[model samples]
Structures are given as C-alpha cells and as structure tokens.
Target: MTEHDQQTDGPGQSFESVWDAIEDTPAEAANMRMRSELMIALKARIEARGWTQAEAARVMGVTQPRVSDLVRGKIALFGLDALVGMASAAGLHLEVRVSEAA
Candidate 1:
C-alpha cells in the first residue's frame, strides 16, 4: 500500500485494533485525559465568546499556529507546563493538588 493510503488508515482501520488503549495504567490515563477535557472546555469557551482561532490566539498572546494546535487536540505536542499556560491564557486557572494516602 502507498503511504497516502496508510495515512488514511485511521486508528481502527485494522481488525487488530484494541479499545483498551490505556488499560495498562488507569490512573495515568485519567491524568492524561485531563488534557483532552481541558482542550474541549477551552475550545467551547472560545466558541462561546465568538472568537476564531486567530482571534483566540491574539487573546492568548500566542501565534495562530499555537492556537490551531491546541484546538486540534494535539495534547502530546504540548508539555504539561505549556498546557497550564494555555489554560491561563484562555481565562482559566489551573489548580494542582497532591495528597498522600491516609
């Protein structure tokens, strides 16, 4: 098959695909899921405010490419610190708390 065809194969294009992608570590995945949720919430906020990606970039004080990446759900492309900064730029604050087991 050509590279172009492989690119269109999507995640589940093969029968060997498994739904339990992160079953190896539920807790880790839960933490990672936060990034997805944040992106969605922020995207909704931007949409609610009637801002285009470019406009949102301006408000976030970032380049249009950065906003495009964020809105496109490129979580792995952004580091955790960068994500927190993005939240702040979107008018939302991030609060991280860690507690030891009782």
Candidate 2:
C-alpha cells in the first residue's frame, strides 16, 4: 500500500469496528455503528420484501432518491434520527441497549 494509505496505529492494534479505528472519538464511532446497523436492517427489509426503490420510499415515507441513497449504503447522507424515523415508518420496531465498555 502507499504511504498515505497506511494505518497509523501500532502493529496488531485492533478495533471492534472500522468506525472505531477511523472516527475521532468513541462517541462518534458508536454513532456510526448504530447508523450503519440501521441502514443494513432497512436495506435487508427492502430486499426481503422484494420492494423497488420507489416502493421502499413510499413505505418509508421518503423520496425514491432517499431510498436510493439508503440502499446504496450512503452512510454519510444519513443520521441516527433520520434512520430511526425511516425504520419506524417502514414498520420496523427498534430497541436500544447500553452496556459497560469492554
């Protein structure tokens, strides 16, 4: 790999998620993890129901372009609240859990 593409951490340093490795703080990483999980869930639900982008958007109460961004895994285009709202609109019940950090 090129020098600019190299990891800065010491050899063998590991993270629970890529977000943890790249985000500026633990809170940011946690937020990204939640957002990513929600996106994946929404995408899977759409696929499972055999819904087109327009159909998914209609069900989620969003525009087709928004659904396109979602299914394309455009994490940077969404936030936690937005994802939660979309999931709810799509009839997905969500639960949050907290645990002590390892």
Candidate with best TM-score: 2
Per-model clash counts, in order, read 0, 0
Q: Stretches of candidate 1 above 4 Å error?
A: 1-27, 97-102
Give me candidate 2's TM-score against the actual structure.
Answer: 0.88
lDDT by residue (tens digit), candidate 2, 29-91: 899889989999999999999999999999999999999999999999999999999999988
- Best lDDT goes to which candidate? 2
Cα displacement (angstroms), candidate 1, residue 90, comes to 1.7
- Give the deviation of candidate 1 from the true structure as CA RMSD: 9.2
> Candidate 2: lDDT over CA atoms?
0.89
RMSD of each: 9.2, 5.1
Candidates in order, TM-scores: namely: 0.63, 0.88
